[model samples]
Target: MKMEFDLRMTQEQKLIMTQQMQMSVKILQMTNMEMQSYITKEIEENPILETEKKSKEKKDDIDYKELIKYLDDDFNYSNKNYYVNNEEEVSPFTFISAKKSLKEYLIEQVIDLNLSESLKYLCMYIVEDIDSRGYLYTNKNILAEELNVEISTVEEALKVIHSLDPPGIGGVNLIECLKIQLNKKQITDKEIYLIVENYLQSMADNKYAVIAKELNISIQEAQRYGDIIKTLEPKPSRGFYTGEETNYISPEAHIKKINDEYFVIMNNDEIPKLNINKTYKNIIYNDEDEKTVKYVKDKINSALFLIKSINQRESTIFRILTKLVEVQRDYFDMGEKYLKPLTLKELAEMLQIHESTVSRAIRDKYVYTDKGTIKIKDLFITGIAQNNYDDNVSTLIIKKEIKNIVESEDSKKPYSDQKICDLLKEKNFNISRRTVAKYREELEIKSSSKRKRY
Candidate 1:
């Protein structure tokens, strides 16, 4: 055990708060509208920063108008009478509200259950496993394995869950669902309960006579019980809209068709309009306190950083969108038929951006156009091949074509995916049978096996 003081001098390259990293994370997360608002704030706060150029070319001015339109369209804030009379009717539109997470709902309801913290969390985990149709499709053994808890503990929590509101909401299967319903109704008739338990499928398929015969009950009594089953809400959360949904979709950009020439507008509104605190400035002008001066300086720096972040975000997004629009301009004017094959790598190379950056920019980022709200990211894809044209066409166009063929085909004898692909090839659109099936599946179309006539 030797105790020695060692001195070492090393000079290694280090990344000290690079702009590129900030641009990738902070700037890309914000939309064009957010960037614009930030830029305005920067100008107000920081005396050092200024816009590069103020061109009055009227290029893209959708930010102000589109924000006002989207907000006004979904929400009614201007109507004083409506606000006064129907205040309660306004839905909650926040991040919490939109999540619709069943775990949160269960936790809220059972706050007074007096369970231990671990058990409480376990209950929440179990609740999340319940499907939208209110069935706990995952087995307790499986859930226990997943949560690294004992199966017995899951079983115990499940019993507590069974006692919750919206009976049948936490059932493992239809048998449990009916058992919950029967428990809630306090039915004395075992025959009626048995009919619900065993012959649920037959009951669903209107095999009431079979169910009545098996239960040794009259068809009328069985029919009455079936009617009662119909009244039970399968999804207990269906009508219960959360009061936390942020009922506003601020677009990444806007494509306005002004006299047929489309203009790309970046959304920028609701962001805080910042300015230098004149009162604080006046205080500084006079014999200001050192602490106050330092605080203002820090805030001013922060404001400038925020502004630069927003401006950079807007510039990158605008550049990417410009390239996208230039490439997919034909799709904008000529409709779905003219959509070309495109990919993120191709766009990234063109704009000198990382592929992931392109992905983030388009993630949940919508663009308003004459065709309504279109996802900005949907423009890029692998093209569908065509005859006399070596390059591929858009898969979207092929799917649209497939959809058309399926829609036109006789419902009694639906066209197989192979037939649709053959038809498209004859129409000079060269596509594979597998590709047709792929596109058809993407469109959520059932295969010939599933689409068979009764």
Candidate 2:
């Protein structure tokens, strides 16, 4: 048992810090809204870094909303505002929308209230904890413990805070909020309270008979109360304070229909116009203090890196989208049904880039079009079995078929998960029973036993 120690580099290697990898992972995980805030913060913190905003920006240029509308299945189809606004009215055009935040509104009300500084601070903390639904998610006990104050003081602060505008704003949950609203409106119906507090779960599950039995009321009565609950605002934060805006990806390509041809315009117009900070460059040239020069150099290098990274991200997105448009041209020209089959590997090989790069470019990314916005990721698909008829099928098409089958099945004799698998296999899908069940669950459909009417 002899120990020989020999250190030799089999290959030149560099050790990467965990923090650097963590930062990259964090950036990758950030939603478009969160990324915007991050970039804005970076701009503020880094002196040399700046955003480039283009002049004469077109209203429909970015096409983020358009892309989302396309991707979201539940988007209102009948909303005329969703389509291009065709009205030709000469109304005064406001350059900027003056929207006030929920936090700011609360602070304004707090100013009129003669509360001490400490109480105000506590109220601010409470207000911050209130989610978009206007429900206070944090417990009063926790707040009291954290502040080293009695629970009574926290309750008192909550009482004052709840009285602010937007009634039922500071409740800990939906039931409490509704109770507050009901009390304020002077509705002394015990049935309403029961429905709000206890029967909500039953109503959600559409178990009318169970709710009626539990409450010792008629099914019709239970349904009426359920209707009332439906009318209540679940999300109290709708159009409230912006608080922390999520980082959103602005679209890089705008696809437009011109005559018979589709036009693809890169929407890189909105990115903040960036340049090297002249002041920093001057400091570097003037032999400023060694530390100052180093600091300026670091800032300049950071700005360059950021600018380069942004450009690369844009280019990667553009290349992926360009290829997507080429492949799915029929979809852009005609409709969704005409969408062609594409894969990350196919794009990666064609573009001479990694499949991961293609995946990242499409991850939470979208493209704006005359029809609407389409998520970049939806362009790829795993094809289903093709029969002797030569009709190509995609997984999306298979999922749609499964949905139709379930939807049209008899309620008394709903198709079992096994039956679905059999039916799909008969149609040459070559899918397993487990796969069918998985797809069914993803569609939020109930099992045959659960879906049975009798």
lDDT value, candidate 2, whole model: 0.68
CA RMSD, predictions in order:
14.4, 11.6
Question: Compared with the true structure, what per-residue lDDT tens digits does model 1 show for residues 101-204?
Answer: 55566668777798998888888888777776667878898988998888899998888787787677788877777678777778767776776667777766
Off by over 4 Å in 2: 1-36, 50-131, 136-172, 178-195, 202-212, 215-233, 239-252, 283-295, 389-392, 449-454
TM-score winner? 2
Q: Give the number of colliding residue pairs in candidate 2.
A: 20
Q: Where does candidate 1 have its weakest 10-residue lDDT segment? A: 79-88
Model 2, range 1-454, lDDT digits (tens) per residue? Answer: 9999999878777977665344544554333445566677778888866544422434334342333332212222222111121222211111213457887788788777999988888888898888767788899999999889999999989988877777778889888887777766677879889888777777777687788888898877877777777776665566665565443345545665568765555554333545544445556667749888777766665555554455555556666666777888887777766766677898899999988777766677666676656676788976665656565677777788899899899977999989998888788777878888888887899888656553
Q: After superposition, how far is residue 216 of candidate 2 from its true place, in Å?
A: 4.7
